[model samples]
Target: MSVTAAPGFVAAGVAAGIKASGNPDLSLVATADGKPVAAAGVFTRNKMTAAPVITTRAHLEATAGHAVAVVLNSGNANAATGQQGIDDAEAMCAAVATELGVDASQVLVCSTGLIGIPMPIDVIKAGIPSVVAARSADGGQAAATAIMTTDTVAKQVVIDGGGFVVGGMAKGAAMLSPNMATMLAVLTTDAAATPEQLKAALVYGVADSFNALDVDGCTSTNDTVLLLASGLAGSVDEAALNDAVARACASLAAQMCADAEGATKVVRMTVTGAASDEEALLGARYVSRSNLVKCSWYGCDPYWGRIASDLGSCGIDFDPSKFSVSYGGITVCRGAIDADHDAAAVASHMAGRNLEIVADLGLGTGTATILTNDLSHAYIDENMGTS
Candidate 1:
């Protein structure tokens, strides 16, 4: 579903002739009120980074860590293009800044799609004016759609928290992993936030969200999440600001899980009572990415053993006999033994688009939640197929 964009932001998507599919491949997002206090980004952990990632990181730092606009393109990942690729990414951001009457350093750039290809700068340059002209409040959704490579649907979420609003969009279907993904997300909120506060909220949000998922265990060089605060909601209390940011982060995280490629179900895996919150999170993430566990969910098999095995491999200090498992509130394992629940009922619950898997480790008072998708044969086919 397309979400309504937040106020104070304008977005546009245009066909920049980057993708062979003839879809809109270039997108631009900007704040209507000139420069906004920006708390920008986290990129992929991959050593072999893309030129845009390299350049954008420097630009953010060079500008004292502020950006008012972002330009993105798909169908060509400008990685391994060397100095020339860096020039193209910078030029794209520069062009947007020129059109918007802002400094070049105030603009950010991103790219996705087939790796190692130089961006077609001429087409992108030609499309900038049109992209700017098409900008509107609801244009964020279109921008999200334009940045997708293999994603079947554009992912977006909008949350209303009293006087403030937080809205964001993301794209990813493959090459997803912890600390990064093939994904790129841009989030905007009307709340007021200092740069430090913005950065803290984003880091905390991502640590518990995007950094916890793995689709194929591969991290893209261009993975990025950019957050911008327009301060349009005026001076909101700290409590209100926290609520707004939390809602925004939660919405974007859920969108990422739902848009997971070929994913038939979104699993909310919660692990509690571990040695620490970190250990609990580690255990949950390990189980979430397990091929056997995800496939079991896909095939409607309540294989409690796979879940337990995955937890064991996380290296957390926990006793096996004290672990418990439940699927959709039906206890499948209790104290490390089968709970003798109705298998048919559990299977039926697993067939839905959303499933909850809970694990209680009788170690200590710590808890964490991770969102993942059920792996299936179609995920392999879709990702591996020659589109």
Candidate 2:
């Protein structure tokens, strides 16, 4: 839940006067080793993305998907601002490069908060120097807090006992569904990895993690998950690199589920015995995002039918007679039919902060796990406050 300072990287967060509320809105995370050896990004599916997303995409492409620093801001999405917005986002990157003595293409930019607002470029420009100067190892937490909108707490994860070190932070609360979510996450590791290897590892990690969660079934135009490897830990060892990236990503993904907005419970929907991993993920994600299923969990209702029905409708080829379900270690349904398990005990188990729903397809060995949050009135109230 916390990231200690690692060698070669320094981060800083500053009140850039971008937000009307006067909170820190700009942050910088950079490495002293110059450019990162490898990087991978998963972006929002929303077609109407912000200027920063557009500009960053271009930079990543131009650099063949590598970066040395990331500059982020909150309170103004910098979306829908057209040409000027693009100009401003690039300017932010250029400014950071000037301060850090790196190429502009080596800096990635991200923004979040109210949509349709133009960035406060003047304030951001003024704050750049200070943020650059303030960068240090422990600045990851501050950078995480700086990019939050309605989030009640900063999301961070770290694992250091292994031979390599991996750490990361994420921000999300509302508008969180996948094809990406209304979220921004950054992960760093000292492990050495080639760009291709890093990209592969990230794709594998997110397949069963960030891509699994949904808060309100709404995707943000700015959702992005970026991973950077400084290679400061030394030459690449394929196995070690994979382990570090997987551990870091898994930890951060769990944090995102646990901190889902107004969520009293975090659920893991595991789908097994499918014909393929893709089919299992398809079915599991369907159950995770079903409003009725989420509400059942929130209300402490043992509605196994809702869960089973949602999974069945996901367009995966499966026999109804082969299905089975369990809630919190209690088998509530078997062979495509309801079980005689005690509903009251299952409901009580669902009331806790963590819940697990296992679905067996009885088809094949392929499987996948989806993470999600329980739906609640408070989630509605929190997001609607700004609307």
Candidate 3:
């Protein structure tokens, strides 16, 4: 159970002939009764936005953050395709709306896969009826699998929040960075919440989850995270709901990092003692997005100098003498200088699949952690094709 773990939601996925490999490439998530529900979305910060992203944003605005359903297709991002792309996205929404007997304004749309290619609108529209008819409580995993692009495995998370459940699914393997990563996710909950409350919770959840991931330091054009609430479980504590949403998002984000394209190691970079939490995040991101540092991680090398150099050049206010670095609980650099520690022990820690790096500025009481992956030759090979 993923999205369907939350009561009042039904999901489905089907092969739409959109992918050349004939894999399932279209998915749908809707209220069990085919009625509109509260929805809020966070989209990519990229200027070159995809057509579905643009249409979905407008529909959410028009409906005042309420949506009856969401239709998504993979294998063609429907981006950079001009007016026809926009029309195709709207057509998908309309098709779903007609099947549910709802206004088109109440439907949302999403697309992910190769960029700048025209979507197979006819093929997708033909598949919509079957996908809609296939919607069932147990179809969440199928929906999750259908949205995967380069992901080696489907990502899903479910949090049991006592009476209410929070469920979510996400997909992304590369071009992952801040302001939302290269992914599409749908989060659902039966808990009662206003549209504003849903948006606030979603924003807080995304802050340290998807937005904190920096796999390849490349943001995609079609990134979107949507939270839909059915209000089936009435009147839960707002604080508890927020916590559940945050936990769900965190779990999915970690899954995405673990399954990053050709990734062998998951790096957790924590930065502490900064002027502010924002500065700490900036400092941590500087290290996470550093190609040299990622390569060093891949090689299982404890190169503290790379970390130091990135932090120094990140333009954050920190004293050089107060900077320190550690790996796997072992202090490798203290006071911006080499610490007398066992090199063999440090090397041993770096060889593990899960690596931890801690940098303390010794400045103030502010900290942040960024999740990233080590650079690998396989990642390079995975991206060499223009398919």
Highest-TM-score candidate: 3
Q: lDDT per residue, candidate 1, 243-352, as tens digits?
A: 66566666666766787778888888899889999898888878887888888888877788998888877799778889899999999998899889988889888878
What is the clash tally of candidate 1?
A: 0
Give the alpha-carbon lDDT of every model. 0.80, 0.80, 0.92
Give the root-mean-square deviation of each candidate in angstroms.
Answer: 2.3, 2.3, 1.0
Query: Which lDDT tens digits does candidate 3 get at residues 1-387?
Result: 898899999999999899989999999999999888899999999999999999999999999999999898889999999999999999999999899999999999999999988888999999999999999999999999999888889999999888899998888888888585669999999998988899998999999899999898899999999999999999798889889999999999999999999899999999999999999999999899999999999999999999989888899987879999999999989989999998888888999999999999999988999999999999989989974
Taking the tens digit of each residue's C-alpha lDDT, what string does model 2 give over 288-370? 88889889889877788887788778888677788888888899888878889987888778777889889998899989888
Taking the candidates one at a time, how many backbone clashes does each contain? 0, 1, 0
Cα TM-score of candidate 1: 0.92
Q: Estimate each model's TM-score.
A: 0.92, 0.92, 0.98
Looking at candidate 1, the ten consecutive residues that score lowest on lDDT are 1-10
Ranking by TM-score: 3, 1, 2
Q: Which stretches of candidate 1 lie over 4 Å from their true place?
A: 1-4, 385-387
Q: What is the lDDT, from 0 to 100, of the residue 118 in candidate 1?
A: 72
Error of 2 at 274 (Å): 2.9
